[model samples]
Target: MTASRPHELVEDPEYFRDVLNSMRMIADKNLRRVRFGLTGDGIAPHYEITVPDGDYMEHSVRFPINGLTHHTHHQSPEPFEVTNLTEKFSWDDVIGMLERALSRKRERK
Candidate 1:
């Protein structure tokens, strides 16, 4: 049998733009007080969704790209939780996680 060729991965700017657009659509549909954009350097990017609880308290879900992995951080008064989603990541996964964290913050308020 002939050996199969390795799949090629292309880093097209259009593809990146499409991905960002999809995330923006998700944020527009479901999230409030959202702030999202590529970092100035274009080497690392991040998006944050915040739910303000009070003057001093807030719940935040942050997605930051580190190397080749996508890392998530949930910040709150209880404790900081970090998750790496590079293995099996999807837009739905990110959205769901944010929703859960926001819900918990709302419940506590």
Candidate 2:
């Protein structure tokens, strides 16, 4: 898991929605499915973009609940890697990270 010094309290509903919206835009452009929702009494939120590789294979870029860091999880034969953001980041940063991870996966195909 990746760890970073929390910069903002994204637990707020409005902020969370905005973040998800921004991520959805990226997912739409990249042909990925965005899955996100609030968890744990509506305090923590989690978002993920899953990119399908084939009929039965896929990979995901996830921002886990309560964690500001981003990580990539691939299917068998690939390993998970976490990236820690040490500075304040916006939704663009997250989207860029996801795009980069997806690009790398494509190269491996």
Candidate 3:
């Protein structure tokens, strides 16, 4: 089963649409789906947000998703492991990355 978030982010009982609106906006801007961050607790995942491990690690990868798959990806210091990047653009994966990035950005702020 997928992990559950801590507190409810949208306190309003009817803010579900609003949340989706925010997510859609982020997706349009990022060229990928972006969702809210869930910081790590004893239960939350992504304790190693910067490092790739298990099903989350990938360096240079060819995405199977058409339209975006043809684009070339830039290299990074992310351990340079070869793996399929289709996960990066997946709805769930994009949201996970977005969540982790959001938490990290808040730490800097």
Candidate 4:
């Protein structure tokens, strides 16, 4: 089963719409369906991005959300393996990661 989020976030219609729209905007054809949630600790925002690794193989990566809405970028890092997900961007880095995923998607197709 998928993990649940805080009640406040789940109950807010406007926030829900915004998050849905953002996820739709970032969806890539090459990757599996994108899933998002807070980290297991339930403090940091996390995204489960299933990206293609190679021929007939794919991997799900947990990427930390960093932005004005999520200010955990400068905080102490999580103890997980996120070496590939850590990159600097003027805004949220997820957009760039998704863009890369899209590019790969296009190239593969």
Model-by-model lDDT, in order? 0.35, 0.39, 0.29, 0.37
Comparing candidate 3 with candidate 4, which one achieves the higher TM-score? 4
For residues 67-90, write the lDDT of model 4, one tens digit per residue. 225323345344234433322222
Off by over 4 Å in 1: 1-86
Per-residue lDDT tens digits of candidate 3, residues 25-81? 322333433222233231222111122233444542222111111111233323223
- Cα lDDT for residue 25, model 2? 42
Where is the poorest 10-residue window by lDDT in model 4? 6-15
Model 4 whole-model lDDT (C-alpha atoms): 0.37
Identify the superior model by lDDT, candidate 1 or candidate 3.
1
Check candidate 3 and list the clashing pairs.
none
Q: Count the backbone clashes (under 3 Å) in each candidate.
A: 0, 0, 0, 0
Q: What are the root-mean-square deviations of the candidates from the true structure over C-alphas?
A: 16.9, 14.9, 13.6, 13.3
TM values, all candidates? 0.26, 0.29, 0.23, 0.32
Candidate 2 is scored at a TM of 0.29
**RMSD to the native, candidate 3?**
13.6
lDDT preference between candidates 3 and 4, better one = 4
Please give the lDDT score for candidate 2.
Answer: 0.39
After superposing candidate 3 on the true structure, give the runs of residues whose Cα lies further than 4 Å from its correct spot.
1-89
Question: Worst 10-residue stretch by lDDT in candidate 1?
Answer: 1-10
The positional error of residue 12 in candidate 1, measured at the CA in angstroms, is 32
